[model samples]
Target: MEKSPDAFRTISEAAEELDVPQHVLRFWETRFSQIKPMKRAGGRRYYRPADVELLKGIRSLLYREGYTIRGVQKILKEDGASYVAGVGRGEIEPRKREGEMASAPPPGMSKPAPRVKGAKGEAAPAAEAPAQPLLPLGEVRVVVNRLSENHADMLRAALRDLGDARRILDPSQGR
Candidate 1:
């Protein structure tokens, strides 16, 4: 069944509804600075309907329209509501209201200066390289198993010791 829009969501629920990872939502909370969800005990997050709507808008801007984190910040600074509207439509173009610069490029287009190798060297591209594809879960599990074997072994040893101590302390247990 479809959940109502007024439903309050945990961080995981909000992330799933917005089609983003919970870590991404956590990161967004740090970057956007405007996304402030109420926190229950034990650091659990509860998002209101407005918070969910804002997350949806931010997700559209970052994933669909390809806005950088900084670009979204700039858009929010200029016109907060308009930015949300643009994101809802999956468009990153800045609105040119009266008296604003009409010929300016969108916020995402503004890039940092290219890095030069040396005084006489040509400037290299400042943009980061395209990300590589992530490894599959099976491969990741194998890697994790290899990496965590020592920790897992220690935990197993500790559990065995606890079991031995329990048997020794129990008078009814067979010697």
Candidate 2:
């Protein structure tokens, strides 16, 4: 049974309201660390109103707006949680580039300022940035058989797991 919309909700309730399966909610928590819900003693997730709104924005970005997970994360970090959550409330719109949807944000919620570039057209550096060192790469090819389109999500998840394993095992990854 569904509870009042104004009240805090469990994972299942949030999933139902968002029209997504429960597992998808769990998956989003793994991909997006910004989603921090309250946890009870037994590890039960209880999402506050803000968390729900953020999740809705994330869902709209990924499923309806066709944004990749990394793209949404960048938007959240650069634009802020309120900005992304505004997308859920239909107050803000994600900027879509060439070959993407052209819907606009509501008035007064105009798109954020464009990045300023230097003389050579390179964007200005962020105020305080972390040291991003590149890892050494070696080509080691692997062949997989019978990966069908229906299993694409599973394949991507497996690839992500493999990447995590690689980062952990390889000392030079610097993750």
The whole-model lDDT of each prediction reads: 0.67, 0.77
User: How many clashes (backbone atoms < 3 Å, residues ≥3 apart in a chain or on different chains) does model 1 have?
Assistant: 0
lDDT by residue (124-173, candidate 1, tens digit) is 45474355584432232221233246655555665566667666887575
Judging by lDDT against the true structure, name the best candidate.
2
Clashes of each: 0, 0
Worst 10 residues of 1 by lDDT: 136-145
Residue-level lDDT for 1 in candidate 1:
83
**Alpha-carbon runs more than 4 Å astray in model 1:** 89-175
Error of 2 at 50 (Å): 0.5
- Per-residue lDDT over 36-139 for candidate 2, one digit per residue giving the tens place of the 0 to 100 score: 98999999999999999999899888877767798888888888889888998889977773331233332345555567566678886878445656443433
lDDT of 1: 0.67
The alpha-carbon RMSD values of the candidates against the true structure, listed in the order shown, are: 22.1, 18.3
Instruction: Name every residue pair that clashes in candidate 2.
Output: none
